[model samples]
Target chain A: MSDSLFENLRLELRRGCLTLAVLANLRTERYGYTLRKALEEAGLEMDEGTLYPLLRRLEGQGLLASEWREENKRRKRFYRLTPDGERMFDHLAAELQRINASLERIIAEAHA
Target chain B: MTTLFERYLHAVGEALPKDVVAADVTAEIADDLHSRAEEREAELGRELTDEEAAAILREYGDPRVVAARYGRVQSLIGPELLPYYWSTLTLALVVVVALELVVGGISAIVRADGLRFFSALDVAVHSLVWVFTIVTVIFAAAERVPQGRQRLARVMRWDPRALAAPSALPPVARSSSLAEFIANTLALLVLLDARGAHRVPLDRLVATMLSDLHLTLTVAWQPALVGTAVGAALVAIAAMIAFLRPQAAVVHEMLRMLGSVVAIVGLAMTLASGPLFDPGGGIATTIGYVTLGAAIAVLAVQAVLSVRALLVRAPMPTPKSARG
Candidate 1:
């Protein structure tokens, strides 16, 4: 009914997906801008501001590893999934798939 | 001129925590901004304006909010300590108000002096500010304290059983509950007894209290006296409502406000009598002083309960969901 309410619900729904996407994409080491561009190319557009902080937080939680490395004469922080992060990403992806399957079944039954 | 890119980088760095590597972070941001500006220029086939660069920075949102996303949750008073903070602050402030009133009342009675409005107000304001500041500082420090140390005592353990317990008693309605009916009836009886309307006669009650005091009980005294009676009547009505509809939240809040008004009126009546001391020390003066003390005590309890009521949220019954 309200635009603000819709935006809030959208934000909440995106929060879980964002974490999963970030983890999955960080399997290969990439700097902040490149990771964001990769995600955007795959249809999940993320703000640079939101993604950078998230990378830092995931690194802090020990799920992602990062280091400052110079590339093309400019230094940038590169992030990639750790072994722990890979395991976490697999677990989360499985859980999300289960939830989506239940929703699909319910929708199909309702339509029938 | 400091380039727009440098200024934006500076703003972001300023909001970041001190522990963050400022130089590395700013350098990364500067490169990212350069790429973004180049993209915009390529699309337009021209270099970006200062205003356009400023727009990009604004689009990133408040630097503080952006920076906060990189840190742990920030709050002046964290959720865990909020309830305790309010309780300590409310209790301290209520006690301070009571002590001020008692001291003022007793001083006036002993001196046989009239209670001046401005001076009494001055004392109340000063005491309130002092109590508020001290309580806030202590609780704020508790909230800011890092983990790994016990801020509260060991007695405040996290027990699952506490979750199932009802934190506060429901509000009293006049008709639905027996206990509420009795409580309200008893309070009314106390009001009548204080007036001596049910027993020793009104004049004797008036004469006994008034003769020792240096007050010319005029038509002005009538308002507060009448107000006490009216407040008592409202309390009786509130009790009846409780007896009828114990579930009505709004009505109970209204009754509580009425009760507060009544207590305030009663206090006004005591002040209107001037100093409570009987010039001639006798049985009448002793009775008068005790009665004054009891009245002040009742007002203090009401004030504290009102503060409690304000703090606690009354849960309303939920309506049925559309899905059902």
Candidate 2:
């Protein structure tokens, strides 16, 4: 039960971070497979189901733009951050840094 | 032969919500899956086997779950419209059942065949199924229109003061009058076209049915044409009156009764002339008889209702000062 609880909490924690990572990585136009590979290289491994749907939702929210184009003799849908998406990413990234700094400070004080 | 990969994509596509763009999503997923397989093949230095592809698909998650992530499965009829849906369904079902019973009963009595009741039961069940599907689809579609609920609410709003006494002539609804007018006009056109030199689609259909039955309706045309024309004309007159006056229930009902009687007499006269089709037996004959019987039964019911309406005493007109 404890293990399952930890796993659930871990997933909840990763969810927002993964979305943030996706937005950050999409600074360059990339298709699904390439994007996943990029995120994996950045130490954020996401399931296909989770990643694709998240991309779709972000696009639906007008934060991401996608278009089908030919690459390597095959059609692939490429996604990138829209202007609004760029602003949102910048805002969220700053917020994350502030939160991280506060968390580190609290942790160091507790340890002392 | 569909590959396991293709089948998996298809399954996912099937599980997606109606509103979702399944084709585009499935295509993207397919590309990703193919990429995964290619990477695995590169690692192993060979093409991946079916089992390896299956493993990849299995790792993704259940098709339904994967689809659920993309879009929610919304209710066809939402909670807001559910009560109205139920009420409409109930009313439609009651009308269908009543119609089936009456028509079936009359057909059985006329043919002296008790089995007609069974056929009627069969027809009733079929009609109920159709009615349920139609009503559900209509309501489901209606739910999608944001303004539909508001429109329906507005239509259903009632005024206590507008309620007339039992003796008062019920106000004629222009919409209903317009509908009646259109129905009568279209019917008259079909009848005239069928009788005259010009052959319409309805005429062609009748010709096909008659040909299939090895029957000729040349003898029956006169009575059928006469009946339909006279009946439709009377109904058209009633519709015009209703449209013009909007407070002539008595006149409308009387005309409607006269129309029903004219149509019934025409049908009865044709029926009295003997069998409509050449000697034949089986399901076709049963269908033909049931159709005729149902038509007569419907008209008879309409006539009875019209008579009842005529019998009701009109309410006394209120003085203009009292109206306030």
Candidate 3:
């Protein structure tokens, strides 16, 4: 039961972080394959099932943009952050830092 | 010559909603899967086997689940109002059952035939389905409206002061029991109305109804009707027995549940035989479809509830000393 509880909480925590991570990674124009590989290398592995749908939702929300192009005689769809996405990414990044600092202070005070 | 990759993509596309940009999604996924496979091939310095390729698809997830994620199927009935939805449904079902039984009992006494009561039951079953559907639709719509959701959530939230005091179970009313017994006895006689038996007056009522609705049943319907009659007879017998011996409550419930299963099978056979109404296009046909659908749904719910009662152990009488 505790393991299940932790898993539920872990998913809840990861849900928001994932959106931010995807936005951060997509600041550079990268296809689904390369973007996933980059994030995995950065220790933020995500399932293809999850990553692709997230990309679609972000695109639908106008936070990201995509287009199809050919490379090495194969068709691929590449995605990048839009202007609004870039702005939102900056705002969220700042919010994360503020939250981290507050958490650190609280932990230090408790220890002291 | 469809490759495993193409077959996987096809399966995903099949699961997606028709309105979605399935082509674009499939194309993107196709490219990504191919890229990954190619990368692996490059590392191994050889073409991958079909089993190896299938392993990757397996890791991806079930096609339908993946498609559903893309659809982002939000809950129609949100978590906040779920408890209220269930409570309301249970209340509605109880009221419907009580009202139907009482009406059926009264109708049987007046008409001097049990089929009259069963006719009332037929209407009750159909109405129950409509009630269920409307309630669900209303709650689902309410969930979409923020203000409505908040109001409903507030209303549903329990207060300490509002809690009812603990009370003992009420005694059974003998009058209601007698009424049910009479109704069941009448129903049995009417259902058993076959060759060399007194013809029930219900045939004329049924004929008039069919004529009004512009329906003409084929000879095939006779067997189905007979099957349902047999099932209803079983239920009636069970009810009459229960009324006489209250201690046989568990047996009564089980028998009733069994009767319902038989009745459901009979109803299904009726549907499988083909259209009950003659070939036509009008409001009557529409009504017929809705009535059939609702009746089936109502019976299915009845069967499920019976099973649930048995699972939870139906209320058995205990001696006063044992009650302590």
Candidate 4:
């Protein structure tokens, strides 16, 4: 595949996983900068504009709660998943697993 | 330190809404660009200049597009509303045109023999009526279209924050005001000429009115002229007010009321004066009076519809508890 085409497919895949990734990472409380770096380390690059708004939206929708706290002499807003978010995340994770298994089966059959 | 990367980020930041373009986002993007440039430089075993980093940032699509991707939902008007808009517009235009024709035909029949007496005045009034009908119908039709509504909505969404910031008035309002001014001036001149002569011939009447008035010493004509001017000015002002404040609803209603009043007065003056103040004989004059009455009726109906549409309130959104 062309690099550009592959990049687009990768972005499409990442788009679905963004909410999941944010929830998974927020299983522990983390600030915007730390969460961004962690996601990049896991090979999922997100820009600040995309991430911050998603955080705000998720919080608005009651999936996440956030508060500004003093950390290392700097004011940082940290986010964490609510109980509702945790239940939603588990449902999503199960659905993702099923999708992954189906995809893997298709790929294995194609190779065989 | 100020760098090309920082400047690029700033350019993008300026394009975004203030709340979206926070200092944190700016700093993070700036850092990413700097790190990427440094990494590329180290890998190549050479120094990457600020200019080279700037070029890379430019190759990435414009900052506005990048920022927009975060949460910019599509803004298209839904397809379902298009048919409603088109049907309503076509129906309204047909009704208005039909009304104009009916009134025009009645007047023509009534003044059939008196044509000679009021020929100039008849032509002028007919032309003015035609022009007003065409212009208003066009405006009403345009307003019903989805794109027109969107354009109107944008104009209406005035932020006091934006008011202090430099922005030009929307082009639609500006152009409409200019057109209204010109139309009013022309209408005033024609109406004044029509009123000035009692029963003179067309050519002689115009010549006499112009020659006697000489354009400069036309102060005596100011009352009628100013009345028409004021009416036109009100309509134009009302349109701008409607454009800026569609939610108010009353502004549009007021415009419709004011327009009806002007039309009524103009029609009454035209009919009562009898083709430029020369009273005609027989059924022709009676027909002219009836035609004037029909025009008044049409205006009255339009005023009622405008008021009804404006005053009818939409049902309030049900509360969450009620929804359950």
Candidate 5:
């Protein structure tokens, strides 16, 4: 009901989904700003400030593989999802779809 | 001019760990800033000024706020330990206050000098400061230990079966009207004979010891004490009658009258009683105005109950829809 409380709860709900989204997009090589822009295109507005830190955390967790190479006359660390990340993503995607379908059914039954 | 881009990177670098890794981290951020500035210039079809770069950096937020995301989470005491911290502080404060009261009471009784107000207060303050400081330091240190949060969290884990079944509980009584009857009666007896305690008085021994400590009040209000006691008695009687004869309008008026007497007794006590001779000898106005303040609080609550009892005779407000 309160705006800040609603924001905090919404942030918590989105935390896991953001991680999954980030890992999924890393299936192809992309750098910090590019990954952020890609996520924005998918309708998730991530803070550019947080994007690099999240990238570092995911790489540290072994869910992402990264390397630096020169592009457009500047060097940038590019990231891609690891094999382990791919398997984790498939499992989470299945779980999310199952939950979504169940929730839709519940809403429909309530309306009926 | 130290450009805003340079200033921003310096701040980020300072927040980061002071090691070789810091260099690489700063380099990454500097590269990101340059790329963003170039993109903005391209969009505007011109080179951006230092102020424009500053605005972009400000939108990114404070360096420390952004850097905090990269650091391992740190707190002196986090939410997981907060409940235990509160319980410990509360328990410690209660025990310390109680110990000071007992020790000060004994010292005043033994010393012909009687209880000095400041001495007892000094002990209480010292005890609280020492105990509170020690407990906080211990918890803060414990919070720094590796895996400490997880270890503490595991200790408070919930089990589904541990909670009591709501349906299994015995039903509450329909009303609790007579709950204060016994308490009021005891207070009345104490008020009736403030001097009577000095007769057989183990309490009088304590009182004599207490009085011996030079902790006596400047003026005694014996009549006001008696009035408060009598008011308490009348209030108890009124409450009992109101409950037993809830439908009787006459009885409700009597309860209201009794509530007024209790309030007047409080006013009289406040007028007649003087300041305690030794303010720190713990609850200094033994048989007088100190009791009056407590009696005033009790009267206020009793007054509310009396008002409610009087209103019972009046018809309840009904919705217009119900009438229709």
Candidate 6:
């Protein structure tokens, strides 16, 4: 398969998990660069441009709260989910589970 | 020495809104680019130059595109507000055009020779109205867009709590006396100064007054004067009611309704006493009649909306115990 095709598949797979990945990782206070690294380490690759704005919007929607802190002579903005965000994350996780189960059933039937 | 990569970073930083995207984001992006370039240099066993780093940055696309992605996560205004904005704009345009035509017809009657003058004035006013309408529509749309919303939020330094707070209706009932005073003063001045009652000068005067006064005064003065002597009396009553309650939304509704009534009355008087006040009976007369009529209609609609808002009670908040 071509590299472009592989890259497209990777993007589609990552896009599916992006929201869940962000909510899960933000359980700990982390800035943009650290969050990106953590997601990559977990096998979900995201670009800097995509991560930063998603963080801001999630924060805006009251799902996340952020504060700027200085550490090791560097300024970093750390974000964490609010109580509302936690509740929403649980709801979304359940919805994603139902979706995954449905997809698994359909694939199993096709193989059968 | 500073490299071309540094120059590119600076340019992007300058283009973006300073408040939304932090300095650290720029620094991190620059650092990442430098690291990438170094990795490439090591792989090729050659030193990467400033130009090569700049080339890599360029391939990443314009800084604005990157910055915009950050802001475009969600819309501010969404599709809901579009209908209301369009309806308001269309109504305003129709009323203004209708007024211009009526004035043109009237002027054509009084002055047999100066049809061209009326036509020119009509074109000029129409052009101005179109320009203002377009600008307002663009502004309203941009405010809804994420990038525009971010810029506006930065400029306005908006308080999120203000959205959750109960709406405070203006104390219209208390301010009726003040409204009446302003209305009566303006109406008497217009009626007495019937000397220069032509449309062009009077319209200019009204615009100038609206621009200078506070919002409360502007809403009150025009309506009280135009509707009736009864409108002036309503203004006093509205002001008193507004003052006594201070918190009641109804006061504002009353004042707005009174103001619209006065404005309509004043317009009627101007039309009825026409050419008698200004015998020039040409382009000026036509312009005056149309402008006054349009102004009245606009004020009347606004007043009605204000009253409606006042009369409607906002829903009560759910008690904390009820949620459990």
List per-prediction Cα lDDT, in the order shown.
0.66, 0.79, 0.74, 0.59, 0.65, 0.61
- TM-score, chain A, candidate 2: 0.94
iRMSD per prediction, in order:
1.7, 0.8, 0.8, 5.1, 1.6, 3.2
The fraction of reference interface contacts (C-alpha pairs within 8 A across chains A and B) present in each candidate is: 0.55, 0.85, 0.95, 0.10, 0.60, 0.30
Q: What is the lDDT of candidate 4?
A: 0.59
lDDT of 3 by residue, B184-249 (tens): 556555654421223677756666777786776554344444555555655665555555455445
For candidate 1, the lDDT comes to: 0.66
Q: In what order do the candidates fall by DockQ, top score first?
A: 3, 1, 2, 5, 6, 4
Best by TM-score: 1
lDDT string, candidate 6, B200-313, tens digits: 457457546534532112222232233443343345334434444455446446665865666577666666653512234555456656877787778678777877776676
Interface Cα RMSD of candidate 3: 0.8
**lDDT per residue as tens, model 2, B1-324:** 128888888999999978789999999998888888888889999988778888888898898888888764256787877877776886687567656744664454345454554587689889989999999998877766768766765665768879756645577899999899889856755665554333467778877777786766545435655675668767866786677667767778888899899888887777666555565456655675677668789999999988887777865777899877
lDDT of 5 by residue, B31-100 (tens): 7777778888899999887788887898878998766667655566877788777667756775675456
Docking class of 4: incorrect
TM-score of each: 0.62, 0.44, 0.56, 0.38, 0.59, 0.45
lDDT of 1 by residue, A1-112 (tens): 9999999999999988999998999899998888888999989989977887788778888999988898877787788999999999999999999999999999999999
Itemize residue pairs with steric clashes in candidate 3: none
In model 5, the runs with Cα more than 4 Å from the true position are A1-5, B17-20, B112-117, B126-130, B153-324
**Model 3 alpha-carbon drift over 4 Å, by segment:** A105-112, B108-130, B137-324
DockQ comparisons of all candidates to the true complex: 0.61, 0.58, 0.62, 0.14, 0.51, 0.22
TM-score of chain A of each: 0.92, 0.94, 0.91, 0.90, 0.88, 0.88
Residue-wise lDDT of candidate 1 within B116-184, one digit each (tens)?
A: 222544797898899888877776676556651155633355676454333245755434555554665
What residue runs in model 1 are displaced by over 4 Å at the alpha carbon?
A102-112, B114-121, B130-135, B148-324
lDDT (C-alpha) at residue B190 in model 4: 44
Off by over 4 Å in 4: A1-14, A25-56, A59-84, A98-112, B18-21, B44-47, B70-73, B76-324
> Candidate 4 vs candidate 6: which has greater DockQ?
6
Candidate number that wins on TM-score, 4 or 6: 6
Instruction: Please report, as a residue range, the 10-residue window in candidate 6 chain A with the lowest summed lDDT.
Output: A68-77
Which candidate model has the greater DockQ, 3 or 4? 3
Worst 10 residues of 5 chain B by lDDT: B165-174
